[model samples]
Target: MAREPLHLLKTVYGYDAFRGRQAEIIDHAIAGGNAFVLMPTGGGKSLCYQIPALCRPGMGLVVSPLIALMADQVAALRQAGVKAAALNSSLAPQERTAIWQAMEKGALDLLYVAPETLLRPAFLERLRAMRLSLIAIDEAHCLSQWGHDFRPEYRRLDCLADLFPDTPRMALTATADAPTRAEIVSHLKIGVENSFIAGFDRPNIRYAIAEKDAPRRQMLAFLEAHKGDSGIIYCLSKRKTEETAAFLNERGYTALAYHAGLDKAVRDANQTRFQREDGLVMVATIAFGMGIDKPDVRFVLHLDLPGSIEAYYQETGRAGRDGLPADALMLYGYEDIALRQRFIDESDAPEQRKRMERQKLDALLGLTETGQCRRQVLLNYFGESHAPCGNCDNCATPPEMFDGSIAAQKALSCIYRTGERFGQAYIVSVLLGAEDERISRFGHDRLSTYGIGKEHDARTWRSILRQLVAHGLVNVDLAGHGGLSISERGRDFLREKPALMLRIPARTGGRPAKAAPHEVARGIAPADRALFEALREKRLSIARAQNLPPYVIFHDKTLVEMAVVRPRDRRALEAISGVGHSKLERYGAAFLDVIARHSP
Candidate 1:
């Protein structure tokens, strides 16, 4: 007798129910309905297609970008005791022949292939002869030219629609904005009504960003709080990534550098270490993490600014994929902002593209400098409405602010009084009486607002100028010698000094105890801490024996549920989510023994 999708969910995957849009998507695909899914990272997007593949006829085909990502998932799926295989360039010709035999013999349940492989006429012709259950395109945003991770091969994926018009096709991505979503829908020929747009909030992650003051020390202090945990520190350049990794290694953290410039063997080794080892940190550039599948990463720290909010969101989303509590911190400064601007200016991209990139950069900068709740700004960018998430730095510490109406008026007066031809530094210099050669040559030292703003320091004025630029009262003419020019809003502000407030993030001498891992376990009962640790210890033992990463055995979320419910036996363990039949038969009794030993 053929098992239903729900039965496979219970007996195979050991989940008692569907979360978010899982059941709907699975049923639609099983019944041959197309969909475009917009779910958050760590939100169980895999189940949407995995379950349908199990219930429907023929092999389920997944098209993905990275070979490493496909390999990780294939490992997990095989561990679940499913017949899955990947055919890629990495496999030898003979090994590929074995995969072909499995497909021909109907022994394979799912086949994961790359876009380049799928696009080959020989492969497509063979696929046409097979009874395909469905086709799923993972990280579907890569198909859009506007996306940061855009791949030219993904654009050819539209061929799937014409080749398999009747097969239920789905495209999935965690980082698609509205335009990208539309592009994906059009490209995949999937209807908007079939789209499932889930909430973008990763409430388990606590967000924090600090102005880069003593950057190395600040990063050291941050890393000190998360000692012996899996984290990734992102840098903009390859050289900076190596330097930061070496610095952390010198300071006693197990760290590795990963970048495009590294030797291929070195890159592969570092990535493997980051995945398999428990406490090693990877200091890498944007090239390091396109399809990272590690689930236990406890934190993601950025040493410099990211290119866009979408890029930032996607990079930080890589952390805490197991649904455990995690931390994401970023350190930004004026220099980082200036450096990013220079990149944009020097790019040979089209003028319109550069203009859009500038807007994206400005959006990220606003989020960094915002005085309001961070989560609100972050979610609203993805078109999700969220209340002030109390877990973020802004909601937790709530940056202090002062009435800046008078100060803003003075700053605007300084810009106008200096002929608006100068940039913020020069304007600020005239305001602070810097007595620079440029200032003296321009004779700006004799102006009325020259020394009137001397009450505030240069940094404070710079912050004010940033806020002005953020609010559109001031525009930095990037093309016209990078001078500061007053917009109509600045003129209106000068006409009527409306109330303006500025935020001041707290800066302490030493890193006060930031949010610890234990502190982040907000919803977990205090009593379950010991049990959770015991479960982790058990998982670690099993993982070590198998020589696999701990998450491949079971996620932290699954263990957390066990600790909460205190499942007594195999049946109870089956009731717990994430414990499939193979896993329950393999480890359920062992876990039950641990729970019994601890239970009073």
Candidate 2:
């Protein structure tokens, strides 16, 4: 039993060895110890429990968040020659009965279920009758209110601890801040000693942010480099998603729209298409991408600002899950921040929650406005330290900064003189001494601070005010009017006359240059390109015939390895990564034939 996990890794999952703390986490679970795992998305988290369930006695029970996610995991497990089943609302009556019988007979290795189903009285009674290996919870952060994606059903999961006191319980998630981790620990009754913090850093993703200037054109420009690649464009609204999808399709790109308003069948079909097909861009709102398992997403684009840094990290983390180079670009403006703030203010949440939301929004804005290393700032939020990652836009093209002490003072004075009633455009107009009718009507033209900002263009001043808002020196009014007012911090700065440095506005749309070509194409030798494409076509054909996503059979990374290694026989092929026993027995010959034909 001790050596079974390592044996299973090489024979079943086809990996040379465990990564990070996976060996320890799996051993802990197998030894009937509770555990908490906070690994990044592509950090081989599932193996921690999957290997344990196989090594231990009886069937393992996994609590998952979404039906689609559960189904995907179940499929992948079954493909690996494991006896896995999912019990959810999507299962037919006969299918559910079969699963129950399988569980009762102890013939199943693992079962994936939602909290709603697992907490039912009948379900709990049936489960108590059977010997269990362990109980694992995926996406455990959903149990906490501080978590970005909170679900009420997840809060009731702690009851499992009492119901099965002897059974080991493990909670796993890819995203959680310190506070959220604390809440999860408290809520689930998991011991603090079992917590494993596997750092929040996805080095394969290149982060970039640009102010929204001609958003459609900017989107097109960014997409130009990513053409014929699978990506997701996240919009702020459902209508915007549809419009963006249509815009892309009209310009000779394959795109689809997804949101909560769509019919259930349509949504499911679109999601399935996005998963099974390559080079299809999914233009969707926030409602679309929580549980998607597509591993080869080449990029993730945010058309507007997300609510918080946690949300941004989770969304962008969805890309580059295959450990390949992927891109994440965000297009934002001052209006997006105001809109997000208005949402927080207008919600029915308590005052405390509203304050927390504001702080989260400010942190996100700081990420967008920071002239320093974006990855460093992001990792610092999660209580981890990383050197300036050269992958992000700021690290690639560093922003120039200038002293703006007097400029900030003048801007603050104009905001105060205008009675904090005008938005940014009006304030910028007054600073430039525009003879507009609204200015004369408001009598703001007579203010002493007017025209004092003529040295900087409106773009520069706008950039200054944006940073000011991000730095907490200025606040946007919550009435949805976009009015700006100084905070206590701004007043302190005015009194102290401290020097401030602001980023100079980039004139060329503020976007990094196009990312390099696909990682696989750039990685393999030119002679091997033909074999790589042929192997990809073979994988796609098998995937389509089996009605599974191409990645479920083999990730592009694995295919790239196959193309480079060019193994000659079954023994040599089995030595390649991702060629587990089940996969080798099933599809090894087909790939080997392609390699043989193309070998020179």
Candidate 3:
């Protein structure tokens, strides 16, 4: 095999070693083999194809969907002194001409284009005439109808097999379950034997989920620990994104709103600022964050429930891409579930697609209400078994499990006695013997199940009922007004009186202190914090001057390492993880100067 990949890895990217399966994947690509790669986000999937592209004899072609992602990757690649350019609608005519001329002369090592650009007959003919190194399809899951983010344009990508029959191709994605994987293989016409299934686990991210109680207050409490950190907050609606962004800004935080409803220029400007600035929180809907390559996102907070486990995983995976400690906090409630279910029920999709969506939503609910390690349940959904990770909220603070069998029996009985026509609020009220007009009209107050749940408070009952829905003991009627009905399993529980363990909801009140035990922060030492901040200011200054994202210059992890190590000169600084020959030559002295000034 060739030794150039390793040499390039050290000299160009400054990493001393190849990560898991990276060497094998790169070797396979260099040997002209096609494959499907199932690596998680931040798993260095790019290097698997990038290294081989450089080692091969011709220019590499990357097919991407997002213009911003293409621009970001090209900028980063050029920062490393590699010949990279992007051909997208955003480029000027002269710029496009320059890129085309460069491609024709083999002056560019890699060229990124939208799938539409690559599929154009003229562009395809030009590419056919060139000596192609390799073709890499990023976010390949979009090609699968079973995938969460399906685009019709991606379906046409299968034609690449006929167009470039001799070029090695690799389809890569971070979020794909078994069915999605099978669909990708069938759609791309790649062999299943060539698949590399890197296990889906982001240990650096701490997973936390709470039932929505005073959501804005809870969001504030969570943000307290992450002051001045870059993060994203996902909402379910455009109005909520605007309101939340305004709310956070009023509270003295730098926040921005993004949605498809906004003007294209305004949306692009907000996204550009979020990318170029540091410590800005972006509140947006699902329209944002598909191909965002920001690495230092300290947290990802979801104010509303995502549609499925795959959507949740893909969104939360945006955080901690630098492999540093980060947090993923999601606050969901019964209303969120009802809203999501109604969306699925109202969609124009076929019955089979709707059924698949229901199952996916059920899987998400199972994750939210599970008493086991949240990571374990999430991985299990993706067909991987993992031991309980101690990093999630459940593992960090084990919930108080009580025998909820009596509570379950009472709830099931109340739903049945009340004719299963009311939602959680009405059912809880009936169980608590509330004197409401609806209850009096229905004469539920006279039922045997009435007043039987007076021992537990309203909050406790709501928790129990929600868990029942999650456990499949209850079903919500999306076609109706979210009426609750007992499932067969719930009836069996009433007859057999099976023991059920349920978690007591945690108490919420008051603002938390600055640093909570579970809150993950940069692992910088107290003594080195000053130097770290100084280095960050320096990096940000340089980035602003160059109009590039701070991460493209150097990731936060590299800064933390530099702060701790206090690299004093060129040689010592070059030993840092991200300091390659190009960066060391261009940026080494400036960073060294900052470190020297902080010295005692």
Candidate 4:
């Protein structure tokens, strides 16, 4: 029996084979099937439709939410020697007309358009005349009301699928939970049988959450420890994004800020720079990740807690696309929980929506506070099970926990002495037997347990309080509200002599040597280092000339492989991973000439 067309396309796309359910999804789409594809960010979701798009008889219609994604995908396909074009708001009238003409003349094999444009009667009429092999909906999670980036326009997508009922439709998103999956199916009218949920595990991404204290300093320390590596710092607000970016820039790092507040051109330029420039760090809000295609990001640090675990998973999933090791570091604080709760309380959403939002927030909090393996906690939330990932901070730098029974008793006694109505500050002051105005005002200095915890520093006591709350021994009474209160566990502890152990928070200030830089430089020959730089420059130039992502032209791995193999001809070049027939035909000569010129 002959090999499937998808297998051939996989070979042509420079992949040794399809991963997970890619083959099944691609085969289904090629057979004119409708599919709801829920694959993680690093998963090969694009190949599901790209392969089928190539095998089908006519142009593939890729409905994307962002103009950047459309342009990037079209550029990538064209670079792979597949005829492709994009029609979006950013294109000039002439460009749109040329694309329309190309479509009518069958000069393009793939056409990417924005959902808004697809809804326009004129564009739909024009599309009706062309034969559409497939309709791919990128970021399909946006169709769900429960999704973080829900766009009202996505609901209109069902009309296009109806209009092109005969064409196969594939809705692709990097992250979607069960509810979002149902929404995609219903909103897009996709059949249940065609739904494909790829495994959500991104094993290459190690997850860690640190309790927030001196976050800016922690961020700087993290950046210093991973210097010259590609990463993203996610903030909850535009101001934080700008401030963080500026701070990183001042520290001599290649950092940029991206948020909706920036002008369109500035955002585009920053994104382009980040993608093309090696080791550039992008500090951005949730608005940033939808269309980003960079593959070598070494880490994703969240300065604030994300609204939901789904959002966090999707955002962090952007790292380590090459299946290399990556880090997902998050800083959580009491303020983050309050901020999320406030948002949920103030929103005009229905009761059910608000409830769901709270559940999601709790899940994120659970992730932040859990002492178990970070990977296990994350995977368990997603209905998957895994053994402890021994790579995260919790596992590698296990906290030194001591019996905190005496400290807990003293802290609780202080809270009781202060009437259980004050915040941590008052409690801390009472525990230290401070004669400050607040302690005097509350008359907490005279308590029996006062001065008992004076041996520990104020910071140490605060750490214990945070850990206590995390361990469910205590709770913050949001109803009381925002004051410390003992939970049932705390009462039980007080009655039965509960034992406690707490991790001393790691101090953050000075920089440590960044993770082994030599690991990245390992395979490169000393002689070919300059040659590698030249190849990268050449690749960048081609990328710029065609307005495509640099990686689409040639990934870093491909360049490294080229340097190692020093292929002299197309046959030799074809043997390198990520260099398929299409890529070799398009880029082989230029690289070969470079290698030949540089050869001894």
Best by TM-score: 2
User: What does each candidate score in C-alpha RMSD?
Assistant: 3.5, 1.8, 2.4, 3.6
Per-residue C-alpha lDDT of model 1 across residues 1-600, encoded as one tens digit per residue? 144877877777777888888888888888899999888899889888888887888899999899989988988887787889998999999999999999998899999999999999999999899988889999999999877998999999998888999889989988888889999999888988889887788998989988765679888777777887889999999999999988888889999999999999999888988887878999999999987899988899998989999999999999888778788998876556766877888999899889988888878988987878999999988888888989888888888888878878888888888888788788888878886898888888888887878877777787777667756677676657767778898899889888987764355732323656543244678888788789988998998898777788888778888888998878888888889988987898889988988787
Worst 10 residues of 3 by lDDT: 510-519
10 residues in a row with least lDDT, candidate 2: 511-520
The C-alpha stretches of model 2 lying farther than 4 A from their native spots are 1-3, 435-445, 477-481
TM-score, model 3 to reference: 0.95
Per-candidate clashes, comma-separated: 0, 0, 0, 0
Model 4 clash tally?
0
lDDT order of candidates, best first?
A: 2, 3, 1, 4
For each candidate, the alpha-carbon lDDT, in order, equals 0.84, 0.89, 0.88, 0.80
TM-score of each: 0.89, 0.96, 0.95, 0.89
Least well predicted 10-residue stretch by lDDT in candidate 4: 509-518
Which stretches of model 4 miss by more than 4 angstroms? 1-12, 400-423, 452-456, 468-519, 522-531, 545-547, 596-600
lDDT of 3 at 489: 76
Point to the candidate with the largest lDDT: 2
